[model samples]
Target: MEALNLNVENTSSKKVTKLPPKISPKHKRINVLEEYKKRNDNKVALNLVVVGHVDAGKSTLMGHLLYLLGEVNEKTMKKYERDSSKIGKSSFAYAWILDETGEERARGITMDIAITKFETEHRRFTLLDAPGHRDFIPNMISGAAQADVAILVIDSTTGEFEAGFEANGQTKEHALLVRSLGVQQLVVAINKLDVVSWSQDRFNEIITKLSPFLNQAGFKKDKVIYIPCSGLTGENLLKRSQNILEWYSGPTLFQQIDKFEPPIRLLDKPFRLSVSDFFKGGISGMGGITVAGKIEAGTIQIGDDVLVIPGGEYGVIKGLEANDESSKWAAAGDSILMTLSGLDILQLKVGSILCSVSHPVPVTSYILAQIVVFDIKVPITKGFPVILHRQSLNEPAIITKLVTILDKSTGEIVKKNPRCLPKASSATVEIKLTNRPVPFETYKENKELGRIMLRKGGETIAAGIIINILSYNS
Candidate 1:
């Protein structure tokens, strides 16, 4: 087995200089105390991702909830209704709110992660509606990797549940993937129950079969909440409908959202932001570029000098906005948009990590990882080529060595340098990226920075966590 390397040296050869903060025209200084007060008053921000198999009513459920919350007005709803009816797809009118793309609307499937913001009485949310189609699993993985909590929408219309929960369906794959990536709390919304006349027996039957599977996937029975709902008719969403569900007296979807415990923010760690999207121009034709992503750790203030890892590009924070509201500083867990100066647009791209220059994430080509293998026809062996996904970055990589295979039940070593890792097994292995180094941290230190997914031929093979960076390449 290769020993883990804990020490990392600064690999950049360029002269380090302290640059003055370059404030943008839209910049405004935020007082620390005032910011704290605002957070306390508004409650902590949370990123809630909705996931399930295709045609399971995820988009419709969320869109209707947003409409009930007045996030979508009657006028806009009328327009969606009229437009969808013209295409003979009136059932998709509610889904049109989150499925903005024409392709998504035409196909009636979520092809990519659709991000939108909403607020409840107690918490503000960044809702990520992930695609459920098998072809779009990579996109779904990207969205789930960023989520703090998840809402798994299950279809309850006769055989729809069985079809989605069976082998090759996305429900099982998505459930295991999110739990492996560290989503602790889940709300399983049994949607389309109205189709079965809100049958309690059907709901109970679904739960009886799924509980063990969810437990195996790492969700605690107590942490998993089951809610019966009708995304089409808007029952048990924002408000409960007593007429349909007279036997069950439980909290609505919004209430369950309010009960979610906010994750502890790593605000004191080194600032790390993964660039998810970037644009060429800034406000008012400003020369600077605008970068949008979530702050994974620590705090970033206006005019703070930032280093773009793997590229060694420097930029200054020209402006910052959290939840589409302008602000001076952004802390961990905030989805922010930042205007950056001092780097050309070509130097910045998706998967770029923005960090404070003094404590930037290490760039490495080789890493030691603890991986959980998913069910696949073939076992994973040494020198197996696969596609590696981290944050928004996806690259080709190979498993260089199978160090040790561990017991899936007790996590004890079963064999050293096992010949192959079979389905539903666990192991520690060395992975080597093919072309360039990536910015990564160990899972113990930073969850968002340390996670990765392995895929091959459009199938997700395994999910892994970085235990250590074994080697670095300049």
Candidate 2:
């Protein structure tokens, strides 16, 4: 919940103040206006989620990319130079960027998600670092939710995928969850290529095993891109290398990402912006929900009439900007921020929906969701009450019906009218909420608006891909 104090100034130093030109920092301005122009010219930003089993090198690849992209700050560089011997593993590069905690490094596991933005000449990638351990699967769900693409890291020398097999040998659970979350693009970075001597055999083996799992995870071949890399040695990330992975003719990690495209979505589906965070600036009009979305329809501008439907409230847009660009108006496909004139914080929650009053679908009870269970220490009971996360809102809901649980790997129903659902299963079930007015929909109908994360006892137990909404006759 900590916003980055992102003060890039005061980075002056002694040794860093006089490094060689190549090693010296190349500062770049992050202007929203230019980015908006590019977007208007059809340049879109891509979000890539770096995920794999713990220590499979997710952090390292991120760190390597950041280093190449000149994002590792001067403070971190000094910290590394002063304590290089104390640092462990190549993945520490990315881990440092995200796992900024003693416990995270000590345990060598990513528990929460950290978002970082890195730019290449071809594209800008927003990295979502998801925890690799099974215990932190909910964190993974939360991270993957924002990603348009996923990069699954596989350690070649281990001869198996990162993270061990689930209780039922469903090591592919993360991949399944990624697909279920509506991330359309996939990239498998067979990391530690140096350890395997960049053997095509090992890479092919991993891909061979991955392809069927990708199928089970419901990913298409054209959508999946595989690359061999070494996060430690920094190969095949930003450049076309002459190293052992020459047999691979595919693009560098950057090229693959730069070419990525979010699947076809209905931009005509009406403009909806869900507030994810709020900051009480110096004044009320100055502070509103921090909303993020590529404008779907109509124009959002300063002083525009924006109805805070969830609050039954009304507000005037006092400010409008996207990607830091001073856009007079943000229309369809422009990711921007808009401030409200009036509304109490209570009227909005993390997952509340913000849309045109004409197209209002407020939060409600009795949600019918299609779920994919990634973790199960025990079965999900019929009456299990868990939390649901959407937008910035997280609310409590109970499983009113077990309904039908489908084994996606087999494409068949393993249980009918089951009292409890087992591990790593996909199902379509009726989830009745304790509260009315939770905004949700069938994921198939609208991915941006239709997904929910399931949390229990303050822990994320599962995530549901909403499939249908049933009317209440009350």
Encode model 1's per-residue lDDT on 1-474: one tens digit a residue.
112222333233222344434443454556644575578576768899999999999999999999999999999999999999999999999999999999999999999999999987788899999999999988888788778999999999999999999968889988977886678899999999999999999999999999999988778889999999999999999887677899899899889988988887787687899888899766445668899888889887786778887777788777778778887788888888888888878877688888877776777889888888888889999999999988788889999999998776666778999999999888889999998887888876787888888999888898878887887644
Q: Report the number of the highest-lDDT candidate.
A: 1
Clashing pairs in 1: none
Cα lDDT tens digits, model 2, 280-313, are 5412355554455444334455555454445555
lDDT of 2 at 367: 64
TM-score of 2: 0.76
Candidate 1 deviant stretches above 4 angstroms: 1-34, 283-285
User: What residue runs in model 2 are displaced by over 4 Å at the alpha carbon?
Assistant: 1-38, 72-78, 84-91, 100-111, 159-162, 165-171, 240-243, 282-299, 331-337, 371-381, 384-386, 389-393, 402-427, 435-437, 453-464, 471-474
| Model 2: residue 227 alpha-carbon error in angstroms | 0.7
lDDT of 1: 0.85
Q: Compute the lDDT of residue 471 as modeled in candidate 2.
A: 49
TM-score of each: 0.93, 0.76
